[model samples]
Target: MDNIAGFIFLCGLVLVSATQPQDEILNNFQQVTKLSHLGLEFADFFQNVTLSDISLADSRAPNEEDLLCLRDLTLFSNALKERKLWALKMIDAWGSIPSGILTGNRHNLGNYDECLNINKDISQGVTIRGKYCFLQTSLSAMLGSDIGALGVVTRIKTATCFPASCSAAHMNLFVSQVLQKVLNLDIPSTAMGISDASCQTSASEPWDGLTIFTVVLLSLMGAIVAVFTVYDYFFCKNHNELPAIVKAFSARANSRALFRIVENTSNPNVISCLNGIRCMSLFWVVFSHEYTGRFFAANLNLFNVLPWSKLPFASFILHGFFSVDSFFFLGGLLLALIALRTMDRTKGKLNVPLMYLHRLIRIVPILAVAILVYTKLMTVVANGPLLQGFSGETACETGWYWTLLFVNNYTNVKCLGHTWYLSVDMQLFIISPVLLIALYKWGKKAAAGIFVLIVLLSGCLFATMMVNNYSMMFFQNSFSIDAMSNMYFATHTHATPWLIGFLFGYFLHLNKGKKFQLSWISVWSGWILCLAMIFTSIFALYPSTQSNTPPLTTLEESFYYTLTRVGWPLALCWVVFACMQGYGGMANSFLSSPLWQPLSRLSYSIYMWHLFIQEMNAKSSRTNSYFSDYQLMLQFWSDIGITLVVAYLLYLIIEAPIGGLDNFLRPQKKPAGVQKTSSYPIQIVSDQKVHGDGPSKLKETETIAQTISE
Candidate 1:
């Protein structure tokens, strides 16, 4: 009769698997089976096992997939309660009773997977916990309620199995066998997956004592600044005693400044083409970071959904990386142009110290403020599964000095990850004075030698990177952070564009005001070649950006990295040269448009805060899933809008005020004997008045033109 019953139970198991629709849980178990190597009938083994021994450990009651895991665990554990032979079968299948848990340093034993907190949760507070992630919640406590696991054997050698030692041999055999078999059956992996699932919490950590304190301090300071700014802007009547705050953010003053910035041909010493290029580059950066900024966000499954090679025409967005080169190119160009002009004005001499000081003054104040806010604010306002250990204060606070010192690119420490650009640019500025002085004093022979040296150094560096298989990316393209630290972010490797910019700037400086007479074909061809170089540089990495395509070979990577970095900057020089020489047609007009002036003014501040806004958006995301293009675009726009407001505030309070404070506080120096004709990188002036004591005010453009006169 017992044999018939067992045979009938076996038939029921076969019938269920054969007739029922395939369950996803069962599929998971099957997938995990490859790791188990257990040779047994899953249906028969499940029939004997039950889940009554389950404990969510300290985890809250399970939900969705987690609930399914607990349900399955209970089913397997319960089956072992009645079937003695099944326990031996499980022992044979798993090889032995599994020990330990899947927490740190114990993911695997010699041959079997561990059954982490199942036995221990009975004594802990294993109640039915609701689903709310605490800042310090343990992984074991999130799966469900646990009474102790049911005893598998009532007696061993006719003694009661009360304290569990009497049936130690059988219980160890049965429990270990059951746990091992269950882990083999897909329970441990499922339970372990709790670590990967998206988690969120609305409640703030009270232990964030420092965050609260910082917020209060910042609030008080902000209120004081705000009140003072308002009073100075509206209430202060005397121009002689004008506060810098009124001069910086005052609506009446800034309105006139904005108008001057947008006036076509207003103070045309600076190439208006730069306005468009800077603005466009900044927008591209925002667009690119729209997707890449989720370094720690939910998977967003972009590689799967938006595979790179498969796209028909919009791959340029992926290559927004070229924009950084454009910036570097522009930096080198401006540095060479201004340095040469300053030396020419100063009798072939440069103020190396003042040049350095001016650059530091331009870049550091806003940077320091942004870092301070990012480190302190993130802990209070945001927290998410992806941001668990990466975002906010911990990512950057210790390394503020490295960034301030302009050596951040060489260090593994990062306060704001994006600040690597600031470090690189600052370092380039520090070094540029030496090169500028050399070129000014030494002439063309020096230029030729330096040019050749640059080519050789760039070539050699790229070759080494490719040979070492440096990932060449701060993103998925990199193999390791160590490699990215040494290769991608290094000043030496990225200096190619900066160096090239100097050459272009020198060329433009020498040829300024010279009219060129070229045939129509020559003009057209120059434009074509320029366009081709840019398009090719931007799109060169299209094939490698996707997951399906194989990684670029060392030769291919070396060639493109070498060519593109050189090509993009050279193309920029052409645009500037052609425009100045009256050869640039539509490209120059569009680039030189006054519409870009305001955006250009905001570009640096925008770049600084765009990533911070992106992180905030990602952490606060309502959907804990892969990002789709539609979703990203919407957030991208939202991020831009918010960033603009924040950037404007930063510019008013910290950035624009730097020059104003100096102008307002110090005794105005009389026009330092006809200063050289050069475009200041940041110059917002009124039609008649320059800010404070700026460039003799109403006569600024005439003065600039006169200073450059031969």
Candidate 2:
């Protein structure tokens, strides 16, 4: 017993010597250990627990639930010792403090250079702020705990280290993941400031190798496309004329043609209100995107705006998800309308390949140009933490296939990320022809049967989500992205909007220009019902704004999400249906006015270019981010203005060419008995299907060769 006691005393002396004479660090280490065992041995460890530097009299203690969390099982305790020992070793090797550590602010992780088999060649550092986040947030849980915690996380995100081959961001991810696996503890090595974390940096050339190759290839292709297009547009008009580049883009030369193009595209025979609705919807989408930009980064004050996100019904800003459904509805409506018109013109013949080809050609050229701009040109002009090696831009270096094939959403490797919508829309369009053909061939009963099946399937999917208690607030939570990207963004989960829109389209086709006799009560009732649905769908979350309100159950949230999607689009269908039948009154006039003509005309281009602008803006400047209506509004308008100018330029260069080619070069065949089917002159349309590989909407198109006489 004396020998054992002697050995235990020696162990204590060794531990005391190893920890140095710093009671502060050891005290903090003990606090972490106490926290780990708090739930299991609360009474025994309570006296030992200390919150490091945190002692808030104004702040309440963490609730029993938070205090009793499944902790890291001394995740930080050993971490503190390992780091202290590593520092001592580094000091011994250098005979002084390590480089760039300044002895603090950013903790150095160079000693762990190869800790996770990462082959890391960067000097990594971890920010000290997030270590206090859980404590700070736990104290403020009832009165907006989201603020400081979120900002700490985001601010911490900005501390990046430059590296060769693998980026600091990648290195950090590797270390955190590998260490967690090795240690059997769910802890971030990056957050711990040990392995792969960096306060040190080195410049990496993004324009090296593959970046250079892709850029040169794109430039050569651009020149060729430009030369061919110039010859086609100008030389075709005057067979022996030398093409002028200036003349190609001059507003004076193309103003009449541009107006003529606009006139040709505009469906004047239909109520102008549809154009108004489309323009408004697209503008709202852009607006919402701008406001939500802070959510993308951890350095921003995201939780400051959590109230807005949590507002439930009144969070029109966060409710951009539903606006996307509006596009699916619009896409289905237009696709059905166009398909029915074509089938009627073709005498029951459906050309699947032609339909697919038309949609593809209309979108691909401009989309390819945009992708090249991001992968090639954008790289030349832009390099920031978010752009150089950290952002989604890097993905485009090799992710073009999943992008072009429109399977990026499903593949989880999006090139543009925004183009997933086009892929989905294309897929839907391809499938849509089959369904429409069946309806066209077999009449109302077939359409009804398909519609019923779609409704049932959508209900089943929603029910599944409910049974599983899947979250509806994809943007509101940090962990929601995986589920959002996989399930919410995919075509399968979101097919409801398209199906609903198709029903509206078929109904409209069947009742084309037919007069309906309606009593005052019915018309009023229809308007009231439509307005009620629109408002309810958008505003139902309002009850959630009150902190006092009860939290929604899994069943309630599931129903709300499912119903919100169906309801928003259904209301829109009614608005269009009523407007078409001349019941919309001033609302119709406002929606269909020529004022919306210019905005709607450029909507597709705006959707394509806005995100790139946002990406550049996000990484180029670093500032303390704050959240407020003023700040969001400032960003919203500024983004719209810049996005508009860029959209016009992209349209002039990339988008306009496709329309110009079809309009000027394609042979106009006036079929003996029927007019040409309406062609949608679009390069890209709506962020509903394509934005973030999540959602974007659509616009109507008319084939360029057929001038609108409507």
- Candidate 2: tens digits of C-alpha lDDT, residues 1-710: 12212212222332244556678645634433332211112212222344342221114564432232212112223333455432222222211111111111111122222221222211244211111000011112222334543333222221221122233333344334433433343433322331232222233345667567656755664575566656566556652352444344433333333433233223423545666777777767776777666554423344455565665523677666666787777777766765676567657676565555555666787777777777766746654333435356668866887878878868766787767777777678768767877888898888888778777856866776766667665433422555566457678777888888888878877877677877879889988998898877777766755578776666777788777767777888878877766787888767756566566666777888887787777644433344566776787787788888988766665555554454443345576666444332121121122222223544234551122111
All models, RMSD in angstroms: 13.7, 13.8
What lDDT score goes with residue 146 in model 1? 29
Q: Tens digit of lDDT per residue, candidate 1, span 61-118?
A: 5445445445434534453455534333332322211111111111111111111111
Per-model CA lDDT versus the true structure: 0.53, 0.53
Error of 2 at 440 (Å): 1.6
TM-scores, all models, native as reference:
0.68, 0.67
Model 1: C-alpha RMSD to truth? 13.7
Q: Pick the candidate with the highest TM-score.
A: 1
lDDT of 1 at 461: 70
